[model samples]
Target: MRRIKKTQIAEMLLEHQLITKEQLETAIAQQKTSDKKIGQILVDLGYVEENKFLELLARQLEIPFVDLKSYTLQPDLVKLLPEFYARHFRAIVLKREGDAYLIGMADPQNLLAYDEFERILKAKINTALIREDDLLTILDAMYRRSEEISHFAESLSAELKPSDIDIFSGTQDFSSDDMPVVNLLRSIFEDAVQINASDIHIEPGEKVLRIRLRVDGVLQEQIVEEKAITQALVQRVKLMSGLNIAEKRLPQDGRFSIKVKDKFLDVRVSTMPIQYGESVVMRLLDQSADILRLNQIGMPKEIFEYYSQLLTASYGLLLIVGPTGSGKTTTLYASLNELNKAEDKIITVEDPVEYRLPRINQVQVHSQIGLTFANVLRSVLRQDPDIIMIGELRDQETMEIALRSAMTGHLVLATLHTNDTISSMTRLLDMGAEGYLVASVLRAVIAQRLVRRICMKCITDATLSPPEITWLKSLKHNEYLNVNYKHGTGCTYCHRTGYLGRIGVYELLPMVPELADALRQQDSNKFQLLAEKQPLYRPLVLAGMDLATRGITTVQEIIRMSGEI
Candidate 1:
């Protein structure tokens, strides 16, 4: 055992402020029962954070910290060592264990480096082939963790006391009515922000109120409470959102903002009268507007470039069709970012504007105030805007307005609730927009969906099973195209789900004369067939298959998204 120097121990005692002359004598007397090192003792006594202890060690030992992610172990070197030795070194062989070369390292004697490497790898390792920079990060993280632990320990050593509680609080003051509605609404929004929720739903029932948050496009139940409390909460939200708190009978809408951490979030609030009570839905928008770019939105480079060119054309309607929560807003935002210019006047009318962009005018649809999509769009056209973005063309009036706008020299971009690009025209026509108008003004319709991306860190090539191969053979494929299957192995980087980000499967319809003529004749099937015959034809199914072949998305996801190719 290494004996600690008296001078070093005294310095540590002084650093922690844990001793005086009398306390030093007491510590010396108690030393027999405490075998911990000076750093460990200081940490146990809550004098410093654990990282601080590691930093002290680093300073004393004069060694560098290392991180594992920056390390790239060579396989050839590890082949010479046994498994036990390799495991002891906290390193892994980069190549196959059986016939391939391997690389190994010695033990992780540097505590700071070891801690950071473990965090990056999410596992225990004695050695790693780290780059010079990563090694420095490891050392820094070790010192940081030590400092944090030391501070925590110090806080814990402080005395604890119980506070007295009133058994019977005043009923009048304790009631929910006593709290301001705005305060309650602030709490709800704060909670939503903390949980990274995209939407909040407040469902009013006969006897109770249900609150749920949509996180990552999935709705999750957060809480349920009494109807009275729920009503109070609703009023609170309405007040914060700037809606009519006193008027509960008629439907109302509002907008508000809340600051969470260092970010400000824009919140759109809507309330509708139901038989039981008022139901509310609030869409949360991240104020930063940090959306993935056109290429990062998951479309292939060629398809992305093709659409980019179409948007630049002087006059045409570009429709993006997809089901709700399929990332249509993100795609539209990306396109707007592409087209936005200081010289051009661009305006948008949305039911609830999801994001705020600089240099673009955004209008919110207020149905209760008789300001609808059609009404706002008609007014927007008069504003002399070069580009108009409608949230959705739901009704005949809005569809007509969108078509006319595109025909009258202004570009229109909007979303429609449709299954695919081919069906979007049918949906528009079904809404009573003329087929001729659609064919003349419609430039392109892009239908898309998001599918999970493969985990690159753990993804390994595996031979397709016989059944899988047979299934691939069943799909319709062009003679010119070859299909290959690939997938990922679950890893820590992807939360053990084998997938990280999502890729988009897009179906783009370009307006060719023959296809326009087919649409004009009400020959949608023929139009689709003729479009397929074109040399540049690539449907949604083909796009999905291409992504699957590249191992970016799974075949199952493609099949689910494109519906059996």
Candidate 2:
């Protein structure tokens, strides 16, 4: 496969006179603009039927042609690799022979896949040329093993005591029933991780304990057993996360790790004392979530290119502003990836080091031991780091250290809690940093919020409501008036919510001389005007609206995200 001459498809077509030279030239040109292979491009352009092209290519390459339309595939066989790896390599194990695997691949000519399959499956790979559509069809089936929750949700059938499972009742102890509780907690963790849920909430109510999972950004209610059982489950979770199971009267925080498949996720558990009982919430921090590049965040092309330019600056503080859970951490990591170099030293100090990046020294802040953000920033500066990332510009001391680092030489990246990019400058000033200091070293401010994306599987054409139509007329999108939006009515894939995943709606502001002058002079009114008039500036409201017009999200989400433009 490494020595495969992919030109065999073109040569075969020429030998059969299946396409004219002009048609071949046209198809090749199209291929340059697309990611499809030459055979797929030729078939797509109607130069040859897909089946015939695949068959001819198969014969030319001396590989078995697999028409999955009529082929039966076993889910267990295809699931030999994790869903992430399966989709990344676009190859799945069809069958195993001794130490070799018969792998289904769209293009049997790929040699890079051989090494990947060997590394993942720990075996050799034999090629079977499968239709691209067929390969994707079975990937969904293979991934269903993880995403389908009905399999492990049966753990809710256990019975329990009704009196809230008293921790200090003196006579009651959970040691005897620890095994069943452990199994139940493991089952709940498995179901949550499989569906890629961001957080799991188990709350105690007067009559029952409500268990819910926050998938994407929406919380989905789940069927629960009696209140008595949930009380036991709460104590079980506290025990697993190393919290004080004997103290339900006060709030607590703890963390634990769980392994699902070949990956491990850190679950941050917190319990808040409530009216009926202690309510538990678990936030899953998957390491793989932070490794995404910027384009995956769904930034508009203009905004993406603009932000990419800002990351190239050698010495300045670039801040992404948003509320907690609004994708600021992900944006910060993406920016760090842009600057990550082998020769240049990069160091980050975070309260809780979430994702471990390669070639970067990461420090976790322990405020309990006086190892705060300011303390760590001062120490990281002494390390002679070329670039530094402070997790948050939390207070005046941390801001002072970060600004000095940026003004001296290092490229600093951090996040702050603010509503907009312009507000970020004001926030820095409010944090007790000198106006001149902030104006001199600040590079760019990016404000963002997460909006759930419409599920592609269930999306259907949508008509504007009367209020929605009236609202659209007031926006700056006259050219987009004819645009048609879409929404998911409801589907199981999205847990009955119209949206499946989250994308960021952003507003970015680059520091210009005039804005710096305004900030330096402490003229808040002038600074506001200068910020609003910056060249090519798009506000968060407009960006979210553009996404709505293009059927990416709904208008309701826009109003909910940015509030009436």
* lDDT of all predictions: 0.65, 0.78
> Tens digits of per-residue lDDT for model 2 on 1-565?
4334557668779888877788889988988889877777778889888887777677777778876544545555776777777777777677877879888788666677778788888877788877777667667644653333323323332434445354323223577755655665666676677667889998878776677878877786754435556556777778778887778778998888878666688888999988877889999888655587887777778878988887777799989898888899888888778778888999999978888899999999998799999998888989999889988989999999999999999889998988888878888888798999988999888899999888786678877788877777787578656777888765446544668788899898888999999999988889989899987577998888888878889887886786622
Would you list the clashing residue pairs of candidate 2?
none
Give per-residue lDDT, candidate 2, residue 249. 75
| Lowest summed lDDT window (length 10), candidate 2 | 148-157
How much RMSD separates candidate 2 from the native structure?
13.8
Query: Each candidate: how many clashes?
Result: 32, 0
